[model samples]
Target chain A: MSILDLGKACTFSQMQLEITYKGEPAPAAKVWRRVKWQKEKVDEFKTDEEGRVELPEIMERSVMQLLPSEFVVSQAIVVTYMDEEYKIWVNSKRSPEKNSELDGSDIHLKCELTDERRLVSDYESDFLTSCEII
Target chain B: MTALDPLNAAELADDIYQVEDEFTREIFYEKYKDRFELGKDSGLSDTGIKGKTGGILLKYPHMMAVMIEGKKKTSFDGQAVFAVKGTAGLMDALTDLNAGIKNARTGGKVHQGFLDVFDSYAGKLPTLSSNIHTIHCVGHSLGGALATLTADWLKSTSGKEVKLYTFGSPRVGLEHYASKAQRSIGAGNIYRVYHKTDPVPMVPTWPFFHIPDGGEGDFLLPSGLHLKPWEFHSMKRYIKSSKGDGSQSLEWSTLRSRRPQDFLDSSVEAWLKSNSIVSFTLNSARLLSAAILWVVKKLTNLLGISVVIAGSTTFTLLDRLAMLMSKGLELAKDVSIWVTRLIKRMAQMLGIVVREGAEMTMRFIRQVFIQAHHAVSELVRQAGRTLH
Candidate 1:
């Protein structure tokens, strides 16, 4: 797993993910991760031969977060394959706790390029995605 | 011929965001060249943040608005369109937090933050030719508040006909302002569109009210499971809802929204007693808030107490509101039961549990109000942080 020190802000919990296209491994697919709250800072990754990508913890140092404001980290993930971009994950993380995205469960997910994106509403977070927790 | 055209206005409101950046500004100008006549001076100026005083020093122009004249074939022919951008930075959100009421130049009291920004940029707009018949003010979110202010201002000053279009806007003024704006702008000339779940339109509570009084000539779209305020407040959602299919505009006839009238005392009590989970949806929040407002109004009316806030007292709107409810609890058993239910419902929504037979003191009600306000402020802050 890679750790991207985006800025001087907080770091997000790491997630393990697998990407598949048409029921086959999507090797070398470009993956982009961006925190919507942070302007102009997007980290890019690539899938391995086994269609697996280890999403490292994203650390952003934002003074804005230090204020007594909301801890809403708008997280987005998109994958590019064959000149087309597909959104795999879009979520607003409402907490600063580790693994809060997965409700304190392990951060392992399987995403299918062909799967339809769906909205999952929980107590602390709300996300729309084509990925599922494994 | 200047009938309300919400879809086209919504498109302008969504597209105005692109002009915020220098690179995208050119693209935005190019894309709309066929329909509008654009120039350098078309950019409206605002006191963008520099440092310290929160834009008091940096009185330069930002790409917040685009003043364009429509071509002959367009629906906005012989008219001007001023599209404003929504909240774009921390400073802008700071402006949203300045919810104090101020006397509006347009007639009644209005939101201080909205009026400050509108006044900052209104003078920068180019002089309209005599040929232009109407001015269409369009925006989303904060821009919606600006549009309302601008519409009211133009209607009062410009001699030209003024039309207002907004999406997911917060309440801009009090009752007097709402009624004044409704009369001046002609209720039919304003199109205030909002999603049922968008929390932005529900805030600054009480005293502050939406224009076109009682939601007349308003468009309320149905939201999907995206109950989160930010998702529902997105300009993309408004644009999509306005355009039904790829080709046809959404027919207003089939898109009539169910206006939520004030809940009766019985309805409020029934919902509280039904043991239904008070979820985080906007409707639930609104219903609970309305019920609380109803109780406060009823109590104040019964006691012949003036609901006005005395500037001398340190009590805030919520503080006074909760105090009234607590006072009501002491005078009548029915008030006690209703206040208890209301507190319980609020606790359930916030994932808190009120123990059975616990004393419902003024402090308890005040604490609940603080918790609820914190939750709402968090939602607003999150939505405000969608900067880029």
Candidate 2:
């Protein structure tokens, strides 16, 4: 945690992310997630044979969202497969609400390795990623 | 495999941006073909997220970098040099505006925007050949911040000698990061060169500290009495200050001694009380910065708190700073005058109207800090706009 260390504000959320190489599931790929505001903690997981990784709801405590300033907890989900890393998710989440990344919808995404990174924008923020909302 | 001379390093930092355009790329390669070898991936490009404006999307070129290998008969023989571009385009302006603190992979916290830009291409950084014995990282402005991170990474992973040369680079990290980087990179090997009037280096102030801390090997180039931040921050202006010849040591020999430590409390107080409105000069700004740091240190020591605690990179540090200054106002008379003088000088520099005794309020002084930071961010944004 960086700015969060100074105060006691907390936010919690969880998401389901799927990894694929070409058309097949990407099993055993290491998925890394970090909340930009709470950067000290990095959540790591290994995808199952189905290429599905369940991110347990993360409850990060920080004062950044409480401030009357720009609230951006840059969310990054990168996957390492076959010694190469790919950015599956890169977003600057502007609101602290759960699932606000997808306008209050559940965090379900299908990411493809072959897909080129594209810029996607919502009212909250802009995301540069290869993942599509499922 | 030696370090690049100051002028050469500045030029490389400036020229790295040229490769972003095809025509300039040809000219760049032609100019250095005899002294260096560039690969296809040498010209680096990356995108930045831009805010949606109206109904149309605009092309936002975020960052550019160049990786050059020194050929035989050149001073950088067997050496690898990586230089990144500074602020340019609308997206870069947004990047400069993203000034939140985040955890750095190497050790401490760094600017979130700088880390994001670096991370976008960190995986793509070309690997140096085994023949390369040393890595020289160079950049100006935002590129300088990225270069600092690159030097730290190369030193940690590549196990090669790393030398960093930055011009008009902003403070990349906090005190913990600065000390850690200094110890990791070896203080003497880091060269943080800046013009006396450049506003870029003065930003992300206080808690955020520049590396090679205590200015053991830093170079402070003096400038004319009046100069704009953009002019002082330009890489061309830096090249003008440094010598082009192969000699690396003599170009900034006389400036090694001109660090922030040169301004003592007495001098700072005298200058502040003099009511000199001409405070945009880098020295005056640095003096005020030094004075503030000094006052905070003294205030903490007086309150039985260690400097380490007060210097922590916490979000409430600004609030704590104002509170401490308020307490300093009540506890010691000298501290009171120092605080008042500091607020006055800071207000003058920022062009904020503050009447007498208004500095007595913690909220008022805290607002000053916030305004100061906002001013710096605006300056960086302006730089980004004009650089494009």
Candidate 3:
């Protein structure tokens, strides 16, 4: 199991995640990102893929889990790629707000799941409890 | 009204000192001494009331003081007149000088009305019980009309004298103040003030009577000294150059504004926080997603791929995935909302219990305080008896 961390600020944008089966070469791997308030699989790639995605940028941002203490997140994000589904559970290590106005409004468009599966929609989906950072 | 239109502030100020104040105090008395006296048979009393110094109107231009002394309902001393200026509305086209609420918003006049202006002269009026002797009226535009009507009303009442001074009063009535008011007010006391810049008073309004070209109405007085206004084109002569009347201008806006500590007030801050959260997430996502879609679209065209084929394929794949996620989120949302509502009801129940408990405790504490006071008083009396 590969752990993925996609952390963000109150005003963060463009969250992405890629998935690969164990022992699969990078070229055979897929990437995902949050799109239009809904989770979507916009691209398909592996280790040998030609998409110019940078690695350090996503890691530098993975400072903490989405939720710190109360609840353990089962998975950070789950992507249904074609017939098969890819799942990654991430722990969020941040404090919960005493008051949350709404999930998407507070922190929306967070994680992006990229794989060979094209799963994003024209209309955005809300980000409420879709992913557990902690 | 003279065919020469009307005199402007600049024109009136000129040749004003020459015609009126030019004569010594003796000369002023001589000119007006004859006309003021009626025919010998008129039976008018020349009382000590006319002993007042200076031109009656100009000396106290604003009726700067209104005090009620001794009896609360006594007749007022000095003039009780209100000058209302149409600083805004259609009347703006009528006069160069505008004052009041209409002028306040336009930054042309003080916002405070004539009744409440503390900085300017205040007219003292006795309480509701007193009979008002007279109410002199002066104004330009809509204000002018209101003043004339007020004066007319005062004259018709038990009051023997009601003097009116208007500056370009618009036609008050289509046929002159309901006829009876005209007769009671009499033509003698009404002085209609006017200037060339004041296009408001003529107004094609009825009541054909007009102010004469020479300053002859009621008492000819300079509206104010416009000497510095006309001679030098400098605005400083007319308006104040200081920040606010030499620093004692205690304005509400100055005292109560959004200060830095206001953020700590919490109640107001919470709304701002909530709105920003909604705005930021929704807005940024919209722009980013649209840009991505645009890039995908442009690249698809450049690759020589059939534009429609690439567009539809990409859209279809993303659309299906979005639809599924949306449905799931909606379900979660419905559940979350229900939970929140249930929690609210539980909190209300808890609140009722807590409030009852607090009230009972407070009652017990109050009873104890009363008992302690009585016991202390009894012990003090016992000690006094033993000492005796």
Candidate 4:
């Protein structure tokens, strides 16, 4: 057995994520985060009328664990709208360093969709999977 | 209908302006035979006009004098109108630009270039006649500026009520010229139609103003439809804006209620198409390996195995080799995910940079305009002090 140091763990005390399609708010969208190993949803909520959802305080230890240096543990915030899932993966090491503070922690996602029915059509899924993860 | 009618005058002016596109005079006459009979093509080389100037004079039974022409080289003479200098070559354009209220009301000094042109047409050509019955002048862009000057000269010389109609015309004079033209022509007689975004109407920036005679008829485009600045200044766009009811016109919609992922997806598809087949195949292989590794990981966790053994071990060499392969697949999966995330982040940053750059450019333009306005005002004030 080998021991590993996964760096300092940080918690987002309070942050709001707003998602917009074009310029308008996306209401009633389901947002959730699943555990890495079990794939069990750890947090879930629906966006308000203004397309805003307040994220729960996320402790790093709950979503991250020590593995070999070469292995990475990733967490993703998934938003489901119209039976389609849009994933925003959080880098455990980078997110805490960049967004550990409450000042610039808020995220604004602007999604641009060209077709409704064929959301993940060939070519589109590759380019648009990460529309604007701000 | 009377030529004084704004809509009729604009339509007729556009039609007359279209005459320049004809290869031969016969083609023009053939086309406009019903509404107008050609009087003469002025400013041809043989006509004694030094420059390559051109203007078409059309004769109608109800309306005797109707002239439409643009600048010789610049198509509309927009550059000439902005110079605002009173040189011999640019006398008409300068006169039009400087035709203040005093000049408009009192029939002040007229440009000699315009006077010479008028005299040549009125005196030598008997068909042209000394006095026009009902003078109507029309032009677009620089042609529009020239038309304004022509209309003013006709009003002064013939003492007839001349009706002026200009499309996308720049400012003709200083404040006084605008006031005088407004009063002399009777605001109702002048019809200026301008599109909201046309840069022509905004020229000769400060102190100078567009002719204030007839109330302006503005053509505004619908919102959200992004058009280049020059497109807004185009005559074709102006004509379209004039005729359309705004409902059926091409415009970008602001609403994004449905799946907003399509735009990204399509762009990705385009990028994929633009890439080499080798790169695409490599990416596919990476993705396939990642997927396979994920499935194996799930199966290993279900089987309650904490670690997969590999390499030189006390167990069979084949079993150790299989374990090593499993460890390698896991590492590959992690690396693949890392690369995909990195690419996504880079793409997002590029988009942000582009949007911010465009916004900064617009802000800079606004700042420059404000600074230029202040600079011009200061120079004018300094000149006034020197005169005093």
lDDT of 3 by residue, B1-388 (tens): 1111122211111111111111111221222223222113211121101111122122232221111111223223322333333222222222111112222111221212221222222122222224434444444433454445445544544364655545444444322222344456665555554432222333321112233212234222222344221111111111121112442322213222211121122432233223222221212222222222232323333433221222233332223222322232234553323222222222232232223323223233233323322332232223222210
Candidate order by TM-score, highest to lowest?
1, 2, 4, 3
- Ten residues in a row with the worst lDDT in model 3 chain B? B47-56
In order of appearance, the predictions have TM-scores of 0.64, 0.60, 0.22, 0.34
Ranked by lDDT, the better of candidates 1 and 2 is: 1
In model 4, where do residues sit more than 4 Å from their true spots?
A: A1-134, B4-8, B15-26, B39-132, B213-224, B245-388
Better of 1 and 3 by DockQ: 1
- What DockQ would candidate 3 receive versus the native complex? 0.00
Candidate number that wins on TM-score, 1 or 3: 1
Superior candidate under DockQ, 2 versus 4: 2
Winner of 1 and 4 under TM-score: 1
| Candidates in order: C-alpha RMSD to true structure | 11.0, 16.7, 40.5, 36.1
Model 2 per-residue lDDT tens digits across residues A1-134? 45643332223357888889988999999998776453445779999999999987655554322211123354667799989999777654534556767777887889898898765644333456788887
- How do the residues B1-388 of candidate 2 rate in per-residue lDDT, one tens digit apiece? 3457676787777666555433234334545666777644323222211121110122344336766677866776878787876542212332233345667889887767677667766776777678888888898876788889888988888888888899888788876787788788887778899876676777666766788645566777765554244456666467666753323434445456444335656876687678767544445557767777777666766666432343455544456566667778888886677778877778888888777655368888888877765665555555433331
- How badly does each model clash, as a count of residue pairs? 5, 0, 44, 15
Docking class of 4: incorrect
Ranking by lDDT: 1, 2, 4, 3
Going through the candidates in order, their DockQ values are 0.04, 0.01, 0.00, 0.00
Q: What is the lDDT of residue A41 in candidate 2?
A: 53
State the fnat of model 3: 0.00
Between candidates 2 and 3, which one is better according to DockQ?
2
